[model samples]
Target chain A: MGVGPSTKETSLHHFRDPLVDIVGSDSGIDLMGVLVFGSPEGNEEKIRCSRTAAVVAECCRPDGVIVETDGWGNLDVDYVNCVNEIGERGIPVAGLNWSGTAGTFVVDSPYLDNVVDFNKNPEGIESNIVGENNYTADDVRECVKRLKIAMLKKGMNK
Target chain B: MGVQEIDLRRLVIKSFHMTDVQMGDENKITMDGKLTIDGSYVKDLAERHSKVIEKIDIQIIQPGDHDRYTNTIMDIIPISTKVLGKCGEGITHTVTGVYVMPTGVDVDGEQAHEFGSSEGNLKDMLYLNRAGTPSDTDIIISFDITFKKGMGQERHAIIEAYHAVDEWIQVYREQMKKFNGNKATEKHEYHDVIRPGQKKVLIIKEMIAHGAMLDTWIFPNEPSGVAGGKSLIDYGCMPVMLTPNEFRDGAIHSMN
Candidate 1:
């Protein structure tokens, strides 16, 4: 059977922690709220954020839990309060800083910068972020190969 | 690699539909059908269908443009034995014409022409007629076509095509309704305006054609760099080219 949308989103969300680790703690990672833009059908913005969120979650496993609102107006204020409530227990509640519609929320560690820039330079991190550059076909092939190896390792570990 | 010669016989047309729903005081639904066929059809169908068939011509017109140039046509001569076995030996017959197009084209004319005294083999053209039951000595001919925009943009082109086909079909149906008398007018009107009997079959065929193009062309494949600059890569391999701010500004402009 085809995967439902929610399951797909969850699976995608699970993939981001590794990259988050590369960024290091001093950079201050902020989990953004849901990124919603464009016609719902086009989904260009949603896909970008979802992919970024998933990758960050994979890279930062155990360090942070990125929260994405289900949609605009669907955010649970009580849930935000609950995360804040947990912060009172001394747990770190990082809010992913996504832009567009659902950009506002409260969090323990808030990364004020927009999440969009990270999607562009997902690999590089530091005081200096590289400008946009087109990838050669070779670059893409290598990335795919790396992703495949990472996926295989993940499956074997599981 | 040079242009690859795909086995035409292996190709088939697949058909499907896209539905859009609108909510209001009363819900409204519209369904657009699609057709997909392999690129090989460009050569194979053109060859096979051309045999025993006379010719077909296609023209593209932009919106507000009155003139049209012939796009392409196929002519074919069929092997008689195939027709005898497939369509039966003793049937009134003539060459049947079939044309398929994406939803972008507005087909205006559908007619048949017979070569003088040439005993055209019917088998080759049998597929052209949906019924395949034509009386012997009768030139069984029809034209099926679609008019739609090229897969990308050309909104005006699609509108023009739709208007042209609509006008033509309307005229044909009216003539049929007149011939069948007033009693058949209502039924004929419904069939003609709402769903044209003859055009419906062609529309289905066009949907298959459109689907094939979408699958092969629109759907991204391994993102191989065109030209000699790069090798094969997966589709959507690149990051989103636009920044969020740029995108947001563009969205604001569109709304305005």
Candidate 2:
């Protein structure tokens, strides 16, 4: 997972914090540690970080994993690669990104599915309003549900 | 910082809508939604920066006229002025439906500003109506500034270009101060409040202040205007804290 700048307004919640809270509060889900990483400066480093993060997540032995990114464009390269690394290990994975219209995924993979685009702008672009197009409580809930379904299909109960 | 039980401050922004813009003998916004720019003032502004600025061509780009060619866009500036109090907490008067775009190139035709110059048709080069771009209904005031030979790559010369445009916009800023609050097309109020029982959150913004074309400015006199701001490079790239209202009020003026 990735975290970027705070939204413009103070009253709204950042996507990462609320998502963590929701997962932590759930009795059925055993939440692992959050992995906060910076944007790698080079392509080789980005790939290295992706594989390393996937290995760490696999060591925790979670039934399902959700990878999210707050940005698009070149950052998508690492985001998709990280998800692919996890999926290649036979782990179920989903994604969360801002790809509703203007930022539609430039690259995709068979390992990537059930992506939630939390864009709220009517024009489907970055409206600049604080928390307008960010992940909400409802979006987070949907992502959790998808993860549960993926686990259930694999005969694993969270 | 911990939360306290007090309202930090409040800011009220009043906006006047402008539908059209044209070059004329005087600089003023009419009551009927037209903005006229005095050509002589622009000529004088160019002369004032003669050491760095060689020639300036001002064009009034109508809405939807993005097929025309332009130099690399240096900045997209909003015209706003402080009517009362300071920047974060005060009455601000601003103009809507128009934006100022400063484009630059050297006398040798080398693009200034970005590492990769986006000098092409405005339509192809810009993603309009985005967070940092002009809307589809905006009237653009394009300041095409050609710098002296080899001056485009100089940090000080580029700063002078931005300063010159800021000075030119001051003419309209003065006019904005006189706009009646009741005549404003839109009004918004923002406040900085502390919620005691709520969880605390801090957002970190990463900015580039490496000299020569990549820099960020903070706390200009006017919203998104380039005058009276401190460069991040000068601050040694230290981390700065700002209240949410301050960020929404345009405290960070990105020069890249």
Candidate 3:
């Protein structure tokens, strides 16, 4: 759930605050906390390259983990690597999809076991995009909420 | 220490749009979106008052350059200026399409950053579709600097490194002051109207005050700006308050 310097959440905007803070609070479980990877503006891959995985593994050590990328493209590499590293710690992993292109959303990420796609839902809607008629912050909140539930179910093994 | 209301006008940032960039005989941005820079002119500026710098090299990187990378990034600066009074005051002009990033390493390839080092290909490192993500249509200027040996972690050495890069950015800060407000693509107005019944909120953002690589600056001349900014570490990482307008107007600058 950590953001990089590339996104306004990590740099300029405070959009991620309520969205991430909702994770442990909204569930009424007090079960999760989003870690800000805080990789520099460029060189986000360093999170995977560094021993940060060990740090994250030691920190969360959760029953499951949910990884969401606020922005699209190259950051997917960082998100997927982060999930892979967390999964290697013997944890089940789920992902929140931000990609809407033709191919390879969560499927592209090798380590993500389950994915929640708000856009794919017939009832689905936009979440965190900007411009004309972009998704509302409510849509993102719902999406993350769904991801937490999906990760919980995945951890339960049906 | 207590509540203070600084005029919101200080944070009014005026901006200019740059469509493209290139290297040429002089440092200038054209009306048709051409940014020309004589690299030597910038190198000369960096060499001054910084005994730690061995050499400075400038490179032009476009949206999709292949196999290109920069190590030890220090700052990502939006070229802008204060049209009147001090920084964070009056009219601040900014160039929207161009950004400057400074990079450096010690003589033995030691990075200038302390804790985490960002060293990788430029393309993969960047995140697109975000607020700060420069468009693929934007121009990037990489000021790659190499420093004297054993100075990578010295507080004064890092400050001098920032000084050298900031000197290079000063070139654009001066040029942007000439832009008229009519030519601006957009204007945003901010006001602090006291609503008697609304929920008053205060958010205390604890920024990094660690010296050397991990440091955050306050009230830079521009947003995420480096030049003429104060280090939080020097201030003992004390709690500082900023109004919403001040926060939006580039008052907090993070560097490594």
TM-scores, all candidates, are 0.17, 0.65, 0.60
lDDT of 2 at B45: 85
Q: How close is candidate 2 to the true structure, as a TM-score?
A: 0.65
Candidate 3: residue B133 lDDT (0-100): 40
| Per-residue accuracy of model 1 over B113-158 as CA lDDT, tens digit each | 1101111222321222111112222221122233321311232322
Cα deviation of B218 in candidate 2 (Å)? Answer: 0.7
Model 2 ranges with Cα > 4 A deviation: A1-158, B1-6
Candidate 2: residue A144 lDDT (0-100): 76
Best by DockQ: 2
Error of 3 at A101 (Å): 27
Q: Tens-digit lDDT track for model 3 on A87-157?
A: 56655555554444421343244566554442331323222211111223454566555545655666578
Q: Give the per-residue lDDT of model 1 (tens digit) for A1-158.
A: 11111111110111111222222111122211112211111234324433443343333332223232211111222224323332333323333211222223333223222112111223321101111111222332333233334334544676
Q: Which candidate model has the greater TM-score, 1 or 3? A: 3
Output the better candidate (1/2) by lDDT. Answer: 2
Q: What is the C-alpha RMSD of each candidate to the true structure, in Å?
A: 25.8, 10.0, 12.1
TM-score of chain A of 1: 0.26
Sliding window of 10 residues with minimal summed lDDT for model 2 chain A = A6-15
